[model samples]
Target: MSASELVFPPGATRRDWMADGILAVSLSLVVIAVPFVWLGGTQEPDPRVVGVSLAMLLPLTLRRHAPLLMLALVSVAGALHLVLLDVPSPSLIAVPIVAYSVARWVPGHASRSVLVIGTFASLLGPMRWFENTTSGNPSVDVLSWGACLGAVLTPYAIGRRAREVAESRGAEVRIAEERYRLLLAEREQQGRLAEASARAVIARELHDIVAHSLSVMIVQAEGGRAAAARNPDVAAEALDTIAETGREALHEMRRIVGVLRAGPEAGERPTYAPTPTLEDIPELVARTSDRARLVVHGEPGNVPPALALTIYRVVQEALTNFLKHAGASAHATVSLSYGPQHITIDVQDDGEGVEDPTDGGGNGLRGMYERVASMGGSLRAGPRTSSPRFRVLAPLPAPPPSPPPTHRRS
Candidate 1:
């Protein structure tokens, strides 16, 4: 709860003011009636005494609003009552109430003043009133002093304990709210990370599919145009290749869109074809052009699906870059070698290096590097140091060894 709620709770502001006003007025009336009641209505009370007593009692209205100021006003009036009044007036009741108010509402070292003042008043107030009384009990003065101290100290102690408990509860509430806020922020950050990862995956897939397909289509269209005037059959074959490439690109795009629309929790199974793997690399190279060739150096073993996809994408992106940067007559060699601890790929083109460095600074190389690195592999792409040819070399970490088979005895 807020500070205002502690002072005047919701829907209780007017009620609190009315109650405090009533309390102050009632206490003032009692202080006024005490002197008359003590004299049994036979003698008149001093006006100055009534005024000082009301001064002590009236500050109770400001107790919750301005506790320090109320205590100060009450203390000054109380001093005056002690010095000027010979009889013990009921207005002295405001002492304990003021002590409680100062203890509860005032915080820090300022509130400690209440204990000191109460202790002093508890000793002095009774002595000021009963100094001339010779009670039969010789310990009457000490007993009066004890009774007065108990009245003030008891309420003050209770108020201090109540304040401590309230503060502890408030601290716990604030800590819980802070923890909840941190949890929400953490969840939001994780969501953003997941979204960025998904986008990167989608972008890499689209680059491999669209860039390779467009490059092949562009090469075939040019070939078909040149051959159309010389030989109609060759031109027809080129046209068929271009059409097939476009249809495959469209199919892959539809598959991606279908996955996105279906969402992860979709009940129905996906109808799209399986992803490409190592077995598909030769067909991919053949589709690129007759100038491109693929050679395998070692026995191909079982490869993980994700690793297979990465290898296929590397080849696709390399050939796509080759078609764009290499001359129209340039020949390309794609070497795939399987080692005991690595799967290596080397794609090279025998043509002058990229004319513009800016053309080589696109997302193609970075995407390839990121894909390889995420699989605990490395990628290197640049012009060959020995010749004016572009080269892409990547070596991926080998998959973990399969567990040995175990035989069970019957």
Candidate 2:
């Protein structure tokens, strides 16, 4: 290792170097007093004491990293200091400090063993020191052992308590981080679900709009082609109707496209015309070239926009299904009625009762269901039980009734 590397490790801060300096200074005092220092009367010093104390204090810098080993070495050094020294040496104090670190780091069973050894050593060393200085006195030995045991226990207990508190704080931090991660994942899943739902709604709207408009144009085109052989004027009118239908579809396609383009892009907001409603039912019937009849009952009152669109889509899908599946000879009846608390729409057709390609689990039918459900409505679609006609009846919720008028007293 380089000289600088030996002095301080990589990323070692000023505070770390300061702490090492402090520990070094404190342990130097213990090292100086242990072996080389002379007692009050003795002129000569013991070389063995100096060697053992230096071994103990030099390892104090590495005590935190290798606490158990450091404590063991310091304990041996303290024992040797008691055995070889003639005069009392205070440098053996490094043992109790290392015992605290061992208790703070080592496993419970091993640390308990170390603590017991430390207490025994603390008791025996002082008593042995007394036996050498004065005569072996029972009361003096007891006092010395008790005082030394109490000193060793104090630091160990404090270190162990601090370790438990630190461990508890670390566990709480981990639990909180786990909970936050779970919450973040849940929010991400919710965003995906919401995006999927929005896409589904847009798909349904586009499917209903394009499918119904195209079905009518197809029927009219077939009629125009056949009728041209008999009456050119009638065929010409059908072509005109097709052109009008195409234009309407184009305009609506632009509106829906604009709606789809809504995002961070500048000036892309949709400019929707008034949406189709029950009032537009007559125009829808007329455009079918007398293929369907419109029958209205009760007062046609204004309804909510969503409910009106639901009624319109139901009629459109039913008529499209009739044209595509029931052959050109089929005729449909479109009916609407305003009730006290609801508005009902019924579309029925008398045609060849062939199965529809887009009938079972089809997007058109699914779209129809979505529309009705959005307006708090219910729809039943199938061939009539007794008749040959296919029918779809949708009943939608409406505004509540106004309070009835009270009779006036003249």
Candidate 3:
């Protein structure tokens, strides 16, 4: 079937259809010229006889459409042409035309069966014609039989070759299409993972933003309330500080909100500025009440954006914990030791230790642990051996060197 399929149709090639057309035309031409060649002794050719020879070849054009059916019909006509004609007839060419179609379009087992039957005819067909006509030489009989076999096999070999080539090309196309589909699926999976990671980062930011800001505001409110009944100036200053802190928190909240509003599919990437870093820790301590102090021993060099944000979170969360659990008279120290290869943070509060665990514990410690683990760091929080103070010790590794950039030729 592959041999006879149209090249433009399905997976067939144009060359196959063209070859079929050429074979059909060649058979038709031989059928038309047979009458002139055979009318040697007769005065003129009979119109009805020539018409019958041409009529048998009408099925050749549709040979590829239904090869076996066309072969059966044309074969019956060929038998009649050989039996009736005293001279060589055009209808005789139909035998080879139908044989070629059967070999090309029929399945292999069926084609071989047809070929075996045709071989028998190749031997007997010439004897049938030679017996009714002249008493010919024995070698000429052999030659006619050889011609029949050669015609049948030439096109069969060509058809088999065409089928093999088509199947090979079709397999290659299928493999390429399968590879493309797998690559597209892999890209889609990567995109989904990236989106999930971005959302997780955003969730962490939301928690830290709201939690830290609210904790500071609560302490300021409590201080303002205690002084409200006494000195009016001190209470007013606390109110002004609270207002300023609230406004600053609101601005940071807007940045987080803008990112959420843009959505994941936004064309222009949303940008937010002035992210908290190591340098901002000084400003952070200045904003808090004077009972807590931050001390740095070494120069904290430049760091990655993510690590800087992590450092800011560690300080913020530790301060929030001190405010919540420590007594009013307690003092806390936030010490940072920036070494050549590593950085360490020590937050110690000399206040009443964490209360009994009857109250529901918060998720702040768990969040802080996860944050430290993500940056390949370690954190320890517990009471010191000699003192009744709570201490948090964290050690972070230094970031790797940046890769050098390439310079294009001028």
Candidate 4:
């Protein structure tokens, strides 16, 4: 039998073997001694008879270890006893016990063969008397044969069915464990991906908020220096603008940092200042007006923080690009339109747009594209009818329903 078919139950220790040996020996002794006591000691038992009876039980001790060999040994001993004594003895009963043991422990074809052979040996043992005697009780012989067969086959059949049930349960447990392992692995992968995506988003927001604010600060600083020598009023105004823009930028930075530092168990709270939306575009455009024309159109309202921040960053990045690449006097237009289902923002400049920004080691357009795409939006930046255009279109998610108002009787 293959190792797969054999299942050794847990806690089958040396003590268990000792216990089984004691039980088998006791049962055999009972089978051998009961008949002699019943016959009232009138018939003197032969030494060979006692020796054969004892020998028959030797196989029972090793039944579990070597079932097939033990059954064969017991059968041979029973047949030899029948031929020598010419009478069935209590030792012959051991044949069915050994046969059942073999059938219960052995696997596949070996177990079936043992059961069949054991049944034949049991029934035929008493039948040998019919061939020898002129007056033999057929009813007693049949009953004895039936009882022997039942004793052997019943336990073997129960053990075989139990083994099959145990094997099936083991297989189900293994399959469940495998599925659990796969699910755990998949969850870990998703967590890593989510972490990576959060970091990328934080980086983009920091770049837009800090970079754009710093650019305005630099320009204002330069203007303040140039005007400090001529007009004190102009320099003071420029310095005031710098201070306000710096404070706003710092506030936004704190929010992003707080979100990054917070743990997973942190409750929902305001992590940062509310994100800038379309309404803030007028102020954003006013800051960089010296070199670019900023245009705003559409009735603006409050939007989700994430979408609002996206709009603010898109415009900020577009203006930064114009200032860096286009000449100081280059013309640019910033347009924002809010519709029922989506919001569109377009930044166009008459300056020369590079066919490939990567060749120049510039990531402005690439960053802009990534930012838009992450929000389930689209961004297109290339040459238009006569100038270069960068446009963003983002679908607005449905607004959550308002909670019902509480009422009291007047």
Q: Which is the leading candidate under lDDT? A: 1
lDDT rank order: 1, 2, 3, 4
The residue ranges of model 2 lying beyond 4 angstroms of the native Cα positions read 1-26, 29-49, 86-93, 106-113, 132-143, 265-273, 299-302, 355-361, 386-388, 401-410
Residue 398 lDDT (model 4): 27
Q: Across residues 1-410, which tens digit of lDDT does each residue of candidate 1 receive?
A: 55654443234266766787789999999888877988899989788778897899888988777677788898899899888887677788898888887788777677878888888988888878888884656589889989989888888888899879988999999999999999999999999999999999998888788888988998889888999999999899999999999999999988887877785678666577789989999999998998999999997687899999999999999998998888788999999999889999999999774553425357888899999999999999988998879999999988867788999999
Segments of candidate 3 deviating more than 4 angstroms: 1-56, 61-64, 75-114, 131-143, 230-238, 256-272, 286-291, 320-332, 348-374, 378-393, 400-410
Give model 1's TM-score versus the native structure. Answer: 0.82
lDDT of 3 by residue, 1-410 (tens): 45444211242246755766676677666666655666764556666556656556766665666666566666666666656664556566676666766666565566665477567767767777677554677788878889978777777777667766767887999999999999999999999999888777776777676666776777778888999999788788888877877887788888888877775677666668688999888777666666789999887766888888888888877877776677667788999988877788889999986552322266667667878889899999877898778888889887765568899999
Give residue 409's error in model 4 in angstroms. 10
By TM-score, who's the top model here? 1
Collision pairs in model 2: 35-49, 35-50
In model 1, what lDDT does residue 97 have? 88
Instruction: For candidate 1, list the clashing residue pairs, or say none.
Output: none
Off by over 4 Å in 4: 1-19, 25-66, 69-104, 128-147, 207-254, 264-273, 277-279, 287-289, 353-376, 385-410
Q: RMSD of candidate 3 to the true fold?
A: 6.4
Per-residue lDDT, model 4, residue 97, is: 66
Query: What clash count goes with each model?
Result: 0, 2, 2, 0
Which segments of model 1 are wrong by more than 4 Å? 1-58, 83-85, 89-91, 135-143, 262-272, 354-360
